[model samples]
Target: MIHLFLGGARSGKSSLAEALCHRWPGQVVYVATARSHPSMAERIELHRRRRPQSWHCVEEPLALARLLAEAGEDQLLLIDCLTLWLTNQMMAGACLDQATEGLIGALSACRAEVVLVSTEVGQGLIPDDPMSRAFVVAAGELHQGIARVADRVSFCQAGHPIPVKGERP
Candidate 1:
């Protein structure tokens, strides 16, 4: 099963995704895309501490499709956030279309239950900067693409999840 969870920053999307991972009767693989930069290193550590120790962590800033392909069938894969992954790809000069296609293909072919968490960045005013605007557009498009293919989709607000597709949690 593929589930897409969307929320704004600090909206408890990651916690919701982690909780859903417990539903799967298999090992959990947490794919973290956030890089530990000097400014956000403490935030990263706090997130790491919140996750369960039993869940295996895979730090992939890019090449999401390859990592998905490598996961075991008896494992549940949870991607913490797609925004960071997209940012990494953009910074690395990756072909956006190819990367998006590759990720969608991999998600379709993977046997393991997959849960994706992403920020809902398009619900605000447009950015004045070109790069920021481009990122917001790309992230919004990516979020839509994933939601279309996912079996379930949800949105979180104030730590409360409201089902947008499929049954309520």
Candidate 2:
């Protein structure tokens, strides 16, 4: 099953995803897409501390499709956030269309249950800059695409989750 969680910053989407993963019976693998930077050190540490040591962690900013395709049926995959992956792809000038297509295909073929976390960045004011506007549009479109393929979707606000599709988990 593909489960998607969307929310603004600090809205507890990651926490909700983690909680679900903890309920899974098999191994849990955390696929982290965030690039390490000094400014993000504390935030990263907090997440690291929160997750159980038994769960394996893989830091892959790109090539998520490959990882997903390789996962076994005995595992549950939790991708903490897609926004950072998108940002990395944009910064590297990767072909977004191809990447998104590959991701969708991989998700379709994946054997393990997957949980995806992403920021809902399109609800705020319109950005004055072209790049920011483009990012917002891309993120909104990405969310829509994922939602279409996902078995379950939830929106988090103020640390509360509201089910958008499927039953509340």
Candidate 3:
């Protein structure tokens, strides 16, 4: 089953995703999508501290679909945010069209339970710059497409999750 967790900044989406990962019976891979930077060191450490040592961690900023294919059916993969992945792909000049479509295909073909974390960034004010606007629009498009294919979709706000589709877990 594919689960999509959507939320704003500091809205407990990661915590909820981790809880779900902990409940999974088989191997769980925490696929962190954030790129390591000095400014993000503390944040990354906090997340690392939250996860159990038994769970494997893979830091992949892009090429998530390829990683998903590598994970196979026996393991459950929790991708802790598509927002950063998209940004990295965009910055790296990857073919967004092919990348997003490939992701959907890879996800549909996967037998493993996949949990995707994403931030809902379209609800805020319109950005004045083209790059910022492009990011928002791209993110919105990606979320909608992923949500359609996801078995479960939930919105998180203030540490609470409200199911938008499928069964609550």
Any residue pairs clashing in model 3, and if so which? Answer: none
Model 2's C-alpha root-mean-square deviation from the true structure amounts to: 0.8
Using Cα atoms with residue i matched to residue i, what is each candidate's TM-score against the true structure? 0.95, 0.97, 0.97
lDDT of 1 by residue, 39-113 (tens): 878878887898888888998889889988887788899998899999999999998777888899999888888
Provide backbone clash counts, one per model: 0, 0, 0
Better of 1 and 3 by TM-score: 3
lDDT of 3 by residue, 1-169 (tens): 9999999999999998888889898999999999999988998999999999989999999988888787778899999889899999899998777778888888888888899999999999999999899889888988988998999998999988889999886
Please, what is the whole-model Cα lDDT of each candidate in the order they appear? Answer: 0.88, 0.92, 0.90
lDDT of 2 by residue, 1-169 (tens): 9999999999999999999999998899999999999988998999999999999999999989999999999999999789998888889998777788788889989999999999999999999998898888888877888898999999999888899999897
Error of 1 at 132 (Å): 1.1
Model 2 misplaced regions, further than 4 Å: none
Candidate 1 global CA lDDT score: 0.88
lDDT of 2 at 93: 93
Superposition TM-score, candidate 1 onto the true structure: 0.95
Q: Report the number of the highest-TM-score candidate.
A: 2
Output the number of the lDDT-best candidate: 2
- What is the Å distance of residue 73 in model 2 from its true position? 1.1
